[model samples]
Target: MRKILAALLLALFASTAAQAKWYEASSEHFVIYADDSEEDILRFAENLERYHSAMSLVTGRAIETPSPSNRVVIFVAGGKGDMRELTGSRWVGGFYVARAGASRAFVQTIRNKSGYPHFSTVILLHEYAHHFLISSARHSMPRWLGEGAAEFFAASSFDSEGGMQLGMPARHRANEISYAGIPPVEYLLDPKAFVESDREASGSFYGASWALFHMLIFDDARKGQLTSYWRLLNEGTDSLEAGKQAFGDLEQLDKDLKKYLKQKRMSLFRIGPDQLTTRPVTLRELPKGEAKMMDVRIVSQHGVTREEALDLVEEARKIAAKYPDDAGVQVALAEAEFDAGFNEAAIAAADRAIALDPSRPNAYVQKGYAQFSIAEEAEDKDAAYATAMETFSALNRLENDHPVPLIHYYRSFVERGAEPSETARHALERASQLAPFDKALAMNAAMMQAGEGKIALALVGLSPVANNPHGGELADTARLYVAQLEKAEEGTPWQPEEGEAKATGNEAKDPVAEGAAKKPTGS
Candidate 1:
């Protein structure tokens, strides 16, 4: 009897092991383990989603990474040497490692941790874009277009009870092309110059790309020609030919671009820091009540970096010190601390802010972002996953055409081992639309489409990034998808274009109710 029981137990154990192996083998994605703690895993996973989303949006196809094998392994690196091994990456801002079939992404989280959330998301998006391009798309996009698009969406955001805002509005975004200060539109679209630029210039390249792309798509005539340009490129037409086929002559496009730039250059929003520094001040001393508090809040909400943000926080705190019960000052301090990456400090300030006035939405949003961050940084998978989801639900209600939160929401779902389905694709689509010029969002949507067997659609989406360095990887990936689609089995359902912004809130008219109430019109 003992022998029989022991054998049964052994058999049961073997069966369980086999089941585990089968589960891991079922999907192409490798689980990336950044650290032993659940917090770290959640954090790493959150970042990965944003990165992957950015990649697909940029390249206009799906990205697949194999290694750390079917699962991406994440290790908390001690120093730069370890980071080099993980990233094989030469990016300017952060440290990470990614290799085919490694299943592990060794990232350096300690050295410069300011934008870990943003950096991790962007880097993952970049590498994942490469994977999808090579494996599924079998094509290559330009490097400049790829990186520029990625940088454009690297700034993430989340919801709060108060309202929606940028996660890290690039400090120098407006500065990158100070109306008269930036290079001409020709230089921005210049493939060679884009490829040769150093790290500092990367932001400029992205800003220029965003501005140019936005002009191309939003401008009435150009929007309609988007599909034609893409089709021309796929047929091996040179960019000039593609432009001619899509728009008209190269000179016409140049004229339009230059004219648009002139209009944008003189706007107050485009003014440089030098101008801001010299601008006249309206108030000599701090005003009383709401006006004084609003001024302080504005300062806190505007800063872009850790140091700059902290300065705002200090000032807010000092004012709150003078008026201990001021809810706005506390909220301002909380927002600044959170932006600066002082999670604990942010929480403390948020608690005080809330205590002073719970109705304030800023307090809720700050606390929510902090909670989500903590959830990402936690060591427990269940806790991390749950926290991320909860925050996303709360955030979704507040966010409108804000792509950043959608990236986080999509990533949280992916981290829980979910497949890229309608829900994921919808979120991805919204992300892209929110930042129409963002290459990363487009690439993510394209990749997701390809994953769902929509290769043609993926190719169509990625066509925009075909000519530049930042988007080069995506172009490669889209080509691969098109080739595969041509040879794919006949039984597969035709891949449809991803969701449109027809269900709009801020960007459209009563889209939600209109969608529900209306019947489909025949094409």
Candidate 2:
């Protein structure tokens, strides 16, 4: 009787897995996973490309297409229930997560409860805006500006005739503005108020932020102040001071914002077909089995809890067993094992992935990271560092634009207690330039500059990060470096002791040994 019941359970499991078919679509900047119709997935990919182009034009930031291994992954669930099952969040309609050297968006094809169309696209674009801006710039803006900009851009509309409209007023946010009275402009500028606000206050904060940003972007007299304010803040000026400096008198600015929000109709930014990409989206359907593995991999990569990581690792092992020759399955197993803290097993699986498909860059990244992890704990670190450096070098040749390899290449020199050679220096500088808001890369670059006696430049580099209000360990580290630099400037002869300034954020913790293991989107 027990055997019969076990067999029945196995049969049920197989049947359930058979239903997990997913279609994949790709464009210049995105890779989408969906169980929807092929036509719909293709259209979604095209829309994403259009959105990317539109944002690039609006921000005057060039769009650098991520390598195939690093392309942003978008998972489209069939409904709210599926999304909840995938993300374990019932209330979250969509979210973007960046970790383990990859960025992904998880969303459902559901109508907005607030009566907006293309809800999934809106959320995806909002997240992409965060990703785009962070990748393009050296500093993170205040929460009010970041959230307001996201809301403003997410209110975009695309026409059937290929026209696009941006900067549309977010009606829901506008309503919230009316319901929850605006906070004082001075209070809104305070990063602490933005970060520590309760849920009710947060609603008002977002509303007020959106209203203020709308006025700044569209109001004729205030339009030019937005850029100036960002420049001031990026230079490490206090937010209140920056606001006052950029926008003249606070009282008049407040009055202008109030009057602007009261207007019945606000202007919108528009782009014609000629201004955006017109390429058709291409899609391919994965086999049912492959699709199932892809879903498991996505879940495994994003697991937050230890038990969850263990379960995902077990599930990934099963998939890897069934598809032993598949490079992707091996890579999935590697990531799951890494998440479970099985560094040796992860390295072995990554090797298998590379053996199966040497051309795939993700396996190389995983293998290098795994080796670096082991090296950090090992007695003979020199050999491991050399091996990791070789792997990263190969990856660099394969994907020249990727920041990970460059980061690791320079980091290996630092770990070995050696000054960066010109080549290493250039690699780190380029990596920082490519991923300016990546705290790990930025911190490493600043340290390298300090090592070279460029004290002033290092301080300038650390300033924007030190001023972040959502103070984490990275912010703390930045503050420490800033203090050290200030002391040096005052002829105090301060210098960071060896290994004293370890990278202290989620993406980096061990300075040279960890490299850029993860990249958080801060969304």
Candidate 1 ranges beyond 4 A from true positions: 1-237, 243-312, 323-327, 351-364, 398-405, 416-422, 460-523
Q: Write the per-residue lDDT of candidate 2 for residues 1-523, one digit (tens) a residue.
A: 1111223223423433446557778788888877666766776677678878898888889756666656787776556665555544466566665432366677766232222446566677776776777676656677678767877888887766666788888765656777777777876787655544465566577678778888888888776899999999877687889999998988887788788877889998888988996566678787544665765665654444555666667777877888888787788788878777787898898889889788878777777877777777777778888888888888888888777887787777777776768998888777766656556557767777787777877876776567544446777788888887876753233468567655565442211011123322211
| Runs with alpha carbons beyond 4 Å of true place in candidate 2 | 1-18, 82-88, 99-101, 110-120, 138-140, 192-202, 231-237, 278-280, 377-379, 414-422, 467-471, 483-487, 490-503, 507-523
Model 1 global lDDT (CA atoms, 0 to 1): 0.44
| Model 1 Cα lDDT, one tens digit per residue, 1-523 | 1111223222322322221211011122434322133444443344344444433444466533322122443333323433332223244223222221122233444222333234444444434443444344433334433443334344433222211122233333456666334344445434555444365554466566545554564577677675675577567675445656766765666577657656632211111222211111111111233223433342232224455454455555565678757676677677767776787787787778778776554565676567666766678856775664564465455434334456656666665566645775687766554433334455566656656667566656555433323233444454444555566544455442345111111111111011010100000
TM-score for model 2?
0.83
Estimate candidate 2's RMSD in Å.
5.8
Best by TM-score: 2
For model 2, give the 10-residue run with minimal summed lDDT. 508-517
Q: What C-alpha lDDT, on a 0 to 100 scale, does residue 100 get in candidate 1?
A: 15
Instruction: List RMSD in Å for every model shown.
Output: 21.2, 5.8
How many residue pairs of model 2 clash at the backbone?
0
